[model samples]
Target: MKLLTCPLNGQRNITEFTYGGEYHPMPDHQQASSREWAEHVFFHDNNAGIVIEWWCHSASSYWFLAQRNTISDKILRTFPADEIFNQRVDFAPAPEVSSEAAPTTKGESC
Candidate 1:
């Protein structure tokens, strides 16, 4: 049986982990176009080489990252997600509508 080491939980059965997908730098959400968004969400290289990916420990429900070799299907290492994403990301809030712009009723009410 194969084993995978969780940075927090130590080494455990491979079945105890779930593969989260290959890691890629995210495009600027505010600046990226619709096509860019779609590509980031839908496209993957699936290259045959060492790549970093996201993984989760099932029992703890803890998420982390892992580096593996696609050709050999070998897991090289694993670490917490915060190691790479040390900074926090904040999104701009949606614009508020004005009272004058409130929607009009479609039918007569009592």
Candidate 2:
């Protein structure tokens, strides 16, 4: 079984945590268009590369950010959610995909 190191609890079973979706900046809801809001709420890159994501410890309900590789499923580092922007990992902005180029299915041909 895989183990995830919790910033507060140390190493623990991966099952003790919940996969909270990729972490991204939120646009101002009041000023954002319907498309922007929808994109923020519904779209995910799910790229087969390293990405930052939110994770919550099921037992303690502690939330944190994790820089993990999607293809290898390896977590490079973990930190508190508040450090998302100030983190020293130097994360680049997620690339935007035009609606015309977005993938539609799990196994659909590109």
Candidate 3:
């Protein structure tokens, strides 16, 4: 099974995750025709390069964006849940922080 990392916890697992979609946004509802809407909702772009995606951590009940290299299983970066729907590509890897930035021993760290 494909596993996603919780942007909050950093640990890799399945139960704590969900695949929202590749980070491409669709046109506004008012601007798109029915056919365009259908295509946007059902079709897959699957761009073969770096992709940003939303991963909802159900177990932790948090949402976040993850940047991953589609050609490789490498997770490039992750950001706060609220930043998922934003039209920003500045979501690159963060500066390596020491243990201070590590997930606190609060949640299940999954």
Q: After superposition, how far is residue 15 of candidate 2 from its true place, in Å?
A: 1.0
Query: Which number leads on lDDT?
Result: 1
lDDT by residue (14-110, candidate 3, tens digit) is 7667778876676675567989988878887888878887778877778788888989867787888566455644434767989977867666656
Per-residue lDDT of candidate 1, residues 1-110 (tens digit) = 99999999999999999988999888897899989989998898899999999899999999999999999989998989998898887889989999889887879588
* Local distance difference test values of all predictions, in order: 0.91, 0.87, 0.74
* TM-score for each model: 0.82, 0.71, 0.60
Once superposed on the true structure, which residue ranges of model 1 sit more than 4 Å away at CA?
Answer: 94-110
Stretches of candidate 3 off by over 4 Å are 1-5, 10-15, 84-110
Give the better candidate number (2 or 3) by lDDT.
2
Looking at candidate 2, the ten consecutive residues that score lowest on lDDT are 83-92
lDDT of 2 by residue, 16-81 (tens): 999999987887655789899899989998888999999999999998889999898889999877
- Quote the positional error of residue 1 for candidate 2 in Å: 2.4
Show pairs that collide, candidate 3.
63-81
**Candidate 1 whole-model C-alpha lDDT, 0 to 1:** 0.91
